[model samples]
Target: MKMRDISESQRQFALLGGIFAAALVVSLIMGWILFPSLAYARKAQPINYNPPLHVEQIGITCDTCHFFYEDGSWAGIPTLETCVDCHSDIIGASPEEEKFVNEYVKKNREVKWALYVKQPECVSFSHSSHVRMAKIACETCHGPQGHSDPKDYLANRITNYSYVVYDPRVPLNAFTIIRDKGETVWGTMRMDECTACHRSRGTSTACFICHK
Candidate 1:
């Protein structure tokens, strides 16, 4: 009778241990994999934009589209007015180019390109300071965006921010990394990245520098 009772107790213990282990596995899957997948919903851009194609075909640099105004403010994205200069007539044989000219340019409608990175309203970033004074190339911070395929772009559902810059927790394969001018560049424009860069350059990272 005593032997039977001991065996029964051991079996119960083993069963509970197995159950606990299974629960832990399920919890980890939900937390790490399932949750993130559900959180970030993929969104499509208003129009298919091929940056590399434009750069290759037209030989136009990034500044041609995103130039600085006379007041030293950065032109974040080109408006229809800017694009109309080239796109008033269909310049490319691609169907997308035709669609763009007819559907948007002819109708005088803006393409409404999705913003990949937008600084918070409280933060003030001087592009001229970084691009001109610091002499940082656009690829240094923005990665090889100029060389990237537009189809690779993804956005977050909750914040409407670019997944490339905002959600760094995703798999490494999701982010595009490229080597430019002997420097490896990838996206993840978080505070830590900025702080690390500042620390490397011995630059002042006072709260007032970023926040108004």
Candidate 2:
């Protein structure tokens, strides 16, 4: 009778261990893999923009389109007027270029480019300070977008926030994974990265500084 009781207890222990292991595996797969995959929805740009081709081949610079206004406020994205200067006619055999000329340029309509790194309305960020005064390279925060494939961009379904790291090299697994205990792996803009960058540069982390 004692032997049977011992055998029963061991069986229960083994079953519980197996169940716990299975639950842990399921949790990790669901939280790390499944949730992230579902959290973002892929969307295409109006046109497939090749930055490196323009930059390297045509000698176009970042500020050529993304220029600063005389008032020092940054021109976040180029306007249709700016694009019209070059794209008045299709310069290349690219179907995207043709589409741009016919659909937007011909219509005199602005290309509604999706914006990444849109901060909350309460937060006031000065790109001039960071770009001009600090002399920080655009890649420092935005990643090497010049070399990135525009199609790799993804938007978070919940927040509608687009990711800046358009690199095909970086895996999307970084989208929503946490390592060890508290280390967050990320591909998109987050408050932690912002605060961390500021702290590293000895910039102000005070709420009022950003939350104007």
Where does candidate 2 stray beyond 4 Å? 1-24, 164-166, 174-188
lDDT, residue 120, model 2: 62
Alpha-carbon RMSD, candidate 1: 4.7
Off by over 4 Å in 1: 1-6, 165-188
How far in Å is the alpha carbon of 68 misplaced in model 2? 0.9
What's each prediction's TM-score?
A: 0.82, 0.80
Candidate 2 local Cα displacement, residue 16, angstroms: 6.5
TM-score of 2: 0.80
lDDT of 2 by residue, 39-77 (tens): 877666788878878877888778999999999999888
lDDT of 1 by residue, 185-209 (tens): 2433657767888889988899888
Model 2: how far residue 38 lies from native, Å: 0.9
